[model samples]
Target: MKLLLDENLSHRLVGLLAAEFPDSAHPRQLGLRGASDQTIWDYAREHGFAIVSKDNDFRQRVFVEGPPPKVIWLSIGNAGTSAIAALLRSHAPEIRAFARSAQEGLLVIEKAPL
Candidate 1:
């Protein structure tokens, strides 16, 4: 699935994700710097991208709007690029399943394994 990495995430993370999800992109790369949450959400919906973000605002919006372009809301806190990459790599299968699954809600990736 295509992904739109939020501005809160490192642009480098996009390149890392490219190894597994080649079609992913960052808002900065897309020239969407400082865009509002709704703008990001609308763009993702229009372009068929699943958003990956640390912000809960996006998750709230999703709950209010349901899914058209799904979301993988990263609930993790203060993580570095490597941490993000490791999580994605280790949980690639689960992530892929969530991306495909018909769950119309936020998918939270916690800061630490529970």
Candidate 2:
């Protein structure tokens, strides 16, 4: 599944995680840097990209509007970009499963305790 990484996430993540999440992109790459959440939401929907973000707004939107572009909400607070990438890489299988499912709208990914 293609992921549209939110502006809050490191744009480098698109390249860092490309092996696993090929075709993933950042807003800056799409000329969407500083774009509003609604614009990002609409872009993801139109482009068939699942939204990946640390923001709760997208999660809230999913609850209220349901899915066409699914959301992967990273709940790992204050983590480094590498840590975030690791978390996403480890959960790649689950993320793919969620994307393929018809009933799921949001997937909340939390950091596992050390």
Candidate 3:
């Protein structure tokens, strides 16, 4: 499944994770920088992207509105973009499974405690 990196996430992640998540997009690249969450959510639903975000807003929305556009909530606080990329890569299988699941709307990913 493709990912649409949220504003809170570094846009560079799209390129960094491209090998695994092809065609992923970033709000800046889409001219959606500073756009509202509703607008971003609508875009993802129309284009079939799982929203990847460090913020909790999208996670909250997914629970209340369920699928079409799923959410991959990154719970890694104040992390660098590389760390975020590594976390996602390590969880690629689970992320794909979550995207394919018909009933689940949210996937909360956090750094494995050191």
The candidate that achieves the highest lDDT relative to the unseen native structure: 2
Give the runs in model 2 whose Cα sits over 4 Å from its true position: none
Per-model C-alpha lDDT, please?
A: 0.83, 0.95, 0.93
Clashes of 2: 0
lDDT of 3: 0.93
Considering lDDT, which of the candidate structures 2 and 3 is the better prediction for this target? Answer: 2
TM for every model, in the order presented, reads 0.91, 0.98, 0.97
TM-score of decoy 1 = 0.91
Q: How would you encode candidate 1's per-residue C-alpha lDDT over 1-114 as one tens digit per residue?
A: 777888998889878878788789999999999999889999999998889888888888888898866878886788789999888777778778877888655677776766
Model 2, residue pairs in steric clash: none
Question: Candidate 2 lDDT, tens digit per residue, 21-99?
Answer: 9999999999998999999999999999999999899999999988978999999999999999999999999999998
State how far residue 83 of model 1 sits from its true place (Å): 0.6
List where candidate 1 sits over 4 angstroms from the true fold: none
Please estimate how well model 2 matches the true structure, expressed as its whole-model Cα lDDT. 0.95
Ranking by TM-score: 2, 3, 1
Clashes of each: 0, 0, 0
C-alpha lDDT of residue 7 in model 1? 92
Between 1 and 2, whose TM-score is larger? 2
Against the true structure, candidate 3 reaches a TM-score of 0.97
Q: Residue 88 lDDT in model 2? A: 97
